[model samples]
Target: MREEFGSGAAGGAAAGAGERGPVVVALSGGADSLALAAAAAYVGERDGFAAAAVVVDHGLQAGSDRVAERAASQARGLGLEPVLVRRVAVRESSEAGGPEAAARDARYAALARAAREIGAAVILTAHTRDDQAEQVLLGIARGSGARSLSGVPPRRELGDGLVVLRPFVRADPSITRAVTEAACREAGLDAWRDPQNADPAFARARVRASVLPLLERELGPGVAAALARTADLAREDAEAFDAMVAEQIEEIVEHAEAGIAVSVAALAANPAALRHRIIRRVAEAEFGRELSREHTLAIAALVTHWRGQGPVEVPGITVSRAGGRIEFARRTGSPRRRRGCADGDRAEGGGARGVAGTPEAMEE
Candidate 1:
């Protein structure tokens, strides 16, 4: 963890430049976000990005509103104006699916709206390299294939002309926590921890609370560093692969009444790895969300068992084949009733739930 805090803190990630414009900090009251808010406010003032903060209250607990208010106060303490805090709803789905994911969806949706209302150019998050490693592990657990394992990007376009930048994805979580602690000490403050962090039922909680510690014991130090480095390498591989796939996409994929269609024969001609990559991407472009490595193999069943009908659902999306082209379409409607697939999260997408950090390796 590498961090400097308070008046002496290094700085926040650049949120563009202007003599007078705002950068909205999506402060979650967590150490990473608190650090990000303070750093942004400090740097924003000097670097032309007027720092504004928004703390979303999911209302999941008794003291959520208080937390938001305190977060707002902390933002003001950093020379920022009063923060705009909003209360959002988090509806629960199935037991396994739960409300946490929905809370995140609702939270980000509010933040996006907040950023738009204030005309802020950038939305900064507090995702650190450790988080990225957990994501890669979670992707592995789901057998989500290579792209999911690559983890989050440092800079990505959010909806409505907002860009989300994660400056600490290259840094460790401890660094930001240290900074936040230093800042809080200076201000005489305390922090809250989410109970979800210790819930063994959630895979990520187990990874963070158990597996990470075990790795430290067995691997003898540098375990987190190793995982973080793995994320970097996977990210590089995924980026290069996407670029190549984009170039050859026209050669392999085409629009059809069935939505995006891929030539199964063309796919078969590529190496096994490239074929799986093409399948995962084609699935996303046409149906939203990725096809797991297991699902990708099932997709190949369309080629191996192509006769009349070879169709199966890949969780949120459906895969089928007609003639020489493999077709992936959203399962919500038939071809007669379909218009298009929504732009999905690169790693995971469902109609209701956006892709988030889910940590592990999965195989079929």
Candidate 2:
């Protein structure tokens, strides 16, 4: 593993000689993170790159600061230079997602800040294969799209030129935990265990404690690996779809008065899946909104089943068909204009794709 890291970091440095900066590890006082810190430090030394560790204390539980300090101590002992412990405030949210999401967002922001201060270009996280499986399961439960099922991305831009890398996403958590604990024991360090991990109140904790174990027992021991593999395949498929969308989107879309307009005939000519994707893309690109599956399908109906239906009202925008085009305009208080198809109004050029008359409507 050390040789692999050394070769990897060497290749990275060889790409841009002067751009090599310190490698920053996110240490959470847990076994996974500790192992990551140790590996990063060893690799940095072997490859002539600087290594640092940042311990983000979310202050969500009692004695969190102490845990951060202990983690920092272990990082320094592992020969990681410039060990840092950053304290972050987690705001409580009553929104759909729980406090875990809020804390994770805050923690990543803090880690990015630390990286900027330390002149680091990369931040490494300790998310393992088990974590990927859990994310896949959660996305499945939520009925999210393929992108959501893709699970934790292996790499992503963290803004300000920093990149977040999850190197352990392919490694099993049990292996990482065992390796980390053995490393700590050899170095005479004690890793702190978070008590919240056992609390059933948290959905993730319940999944970890009950759901994964039961599945492994009933369905054999390979279920987690299978889920992780599914995430990888989904990510590749989603990336291909994104590339396709980017290549063809501009041809059928144009800027409208207050929003964007797409060609109805052009959208209808494509397959239903691509048409739905294009509609969602337009909503996101023009209005900075992610349309729900229902809203997307409703808008698609204006293209496929133009039954003189009124405008479909989605959050922050309205969709209507007129002038052989589907217009997505911003919602306003004043009355707006809409065009509907009369009975027996046939589509123009293509088969069944036109709204003959104009029907004016407004969303207040």
Candidate 3:
């Protein structure tokens, strides 16, 4: 697990902190996070860095505050200093992706606030191999692309100077949730189990309780490990493609009058895969909208199969082929509009693909 922190921003933050700054752990009173807190306490003392714990109460369930306090007390018992409990309101109905997403967003926001207030060097999360495998399965069910299938990232920049590290998820052999439970038991910590994790109404709980077990039972063992491995490979491929896009985007994309334009010739020169990525990237970066597969392919046609088509209107952007360039501008008035071209002008014969970095991509 220590080797997992040896590279990346995790190592840099730890080394830079010396003895002045602390490493904060997000403890949920669950086995996974509790084990992480235990490990951090030992590692922080051994390496001469301060360790702290934060427990976020979403206020969705009864007795949530008590649960948060219990977790914070356990952290203190483990010798973590400055244990804190944060309460956040989660507006589940108003959030676009439903309750689970709302809770996650609120939780992270609280954690980030705690880290910033403490001037912490790094924040640790307890996502394990099982979580990674579940994410991949969820992505598959959504018919998502490589980025979604890549699963949760091990290290993510949470803006400011804060970084969130998931040492368990990135462990070389991959740490399982069971291992965390065992660790808590050995350390004599009474871990709290969240009821939502076992609730059938939640998609993740369904996947964890049924889908994964059935696959393992029928196909034999190691299915979860295989899925996690698939996420690793897919992430590598997605990162490479992202780098390629970044390298060429400056040369091919430029700002237009009221929107952005991509050189149609350059787009047509690249393969279909790269072309779709560039198109999606343009929409996301410029307009803050995610292009669905149908919309993406429709825009791709403006460059590859141009036949004097007018403009193609997606959910929030209007795409057109004009003067040897593909132009994307904000859509006004009615959300659906078509000019000159027939409804069948869209590029055809492709399955649904989720745009990377969008909520739809990371459904779980």
Error of model 2, residue 286, in angstroms: 2.6
Better of 2 and 3 by TM-score: 3
List residue ranges in candidate 2 displaced over 4 A. 1-18, 94-96, 170-188, 332-364
Query: Candidates' TM-scores?
Result: 0.80, 0.83, 0.89
**lDDT values of the candidates?**
0.67, 0.73, 0.80
The CA-based lDDT of model 2 is what? 0.73
- Per-residue lDDT of candidate 1, residues 1-364 (tens digit): 2224422332545535353257778887876677777767667666655778889999988888988888888778877654899999888655224455667667778988988788777777877656766776677665555666777676778755678777766543434344566665555545557786789987778888898779889989877667667778888888888888887787878887857788878887787777777887777776667555556777887876566754656666767887788877666643222224343332122432323323122110
lDDT of 2 by residue, 240-355 (tens): 88887876686888877867888988999998768888888888887886666667888999999999987776656778998789999987552343354232211111121111
Off by over 4 Å in 3: 1-20, 93-95, 336-364
Model 1 spans > 4 angstroms off: 1-12, 15-20, 94-96, 171-183, 186-189, 304-323, 327-364
Between the candidate structures 1 and 2, which one is better when assessed by TM-score? Answer: 2
Predictions: Cα RMSD each: 6.5, 9.0, 4.1
Best by the TM-score measure = 3
Candidate 2 residue pairs in clash (backbone atoms < 3 Å): 338-359, 338-360, 339-359, 347-354
Candidate 3 lDDT (Cα, whole model)? 0.80
For model 3, where is the 10-residue window of minimal lDDT? 347-356
